[model samples]
Target: FFFIMNLQQITREKHTYMLQTGDLRQELKKQEGYVEEQRESLFSRLVELEQSAADYCEQIGNFHTNCLQTVSSMKQNRESATENATKYQQTVEDLEKWLSS
Candidate 1:
């Protein structure tokens, strides 16, 4: 009789351990799914950030080009003004010489 009772007890313990193992496996599956979802979300965010950075770089490049053009225009205008002033001074000097003669 004692041997039979020992066998039954052992069977019961085995069944309990199997159930606990199944529960742990289910929990692990759930955790893995959550981790996968988080990874996908982070990947999506990273893509968006990369696109934004590209857009900003393009805008900065455009701004730099516009600034260079403006500086070139200003330099041209300054050169024109200097040429005009030199011509005006030459004209004044020629008129003075004529008057003195």
Candidate 2:
């Protein structure tokens, strides 16, 4: 009778352990799925950030090109203005010499 009781106790302990292990396995699976979901979300956000950075860099390059063009245009206008001023000075001096003579 004692041996039979011992066997029954062992069987009950084994059943309880199996139930607990099954629950733990289910919880582990859920945690793994959650981790995978978070990783995918992070990857998607990283891609978006990279795209935004690329666009910002492109805009900066375009702005720099435009500024260089504007500077070149201003330099040319300044040179033309200086030449015109020299010519006007020469004409004025010539007229004064003719009038004095």
Candidate 3:
């Protein structure tokens, strides 16, 4: 009768351990799912940030190109204005000489 009691107790303990292990397995699965979701969310955010950075770099490049063109145009306009001023000075001097004569 004692041996039978011991066997029954052993079976009960085994059943309890199985139940606890099953609960732990379910908790582990839930944690793994949460971690995967977080990883996917972070990866998506990273992709968006990278795209934004690329767009900003492209805009900066375009702005730099426009600045260079504007500088070149200003230089050309300044040169033309200087040439015109010199020609006008020559014309004024010639008119003065004729009037004096």
TM-score of 2: 0.78
What ranking of all candidate models by TM-score puts the best one first? Answer: 3, 2, 1
lDDT of 2 by residue, 1-101 (tens): 99999999999999999999999999999999999999999999999999999999999999999999999999999999999999999999999999999
Model 3 score (lDDT) = 0.99
Q: All candidates' lDDT scores?
A: 0.99, 0.99, 0.99
Error of 3 at 34 (Å): 1.0
**For residues 1-101, could you state the per-residue lDDT of candidate 3 as single tens digits?**
99999999999999999999999999999999999999999999999999999999999999999999999999999999999999999999999999999
C-alpha-based local distance difference test score of model 1:
0.99
Worst window of 10 by summed lDDT in candidate 1: 13-22
List of clashing residue pairs for candidate 3: none
Per-prediction TM-score to the true structure, in the order listed = 0.77, 0.78, 0.78
TM-score of 1: 0.77
Clash pairs detected, candidate 2:
none
Across residues 1-85, which tens digit of lDDT does each residue of candidate 1 receive?
9999999999999999999999999999999999999999999999999999999999999999999999999999999999999
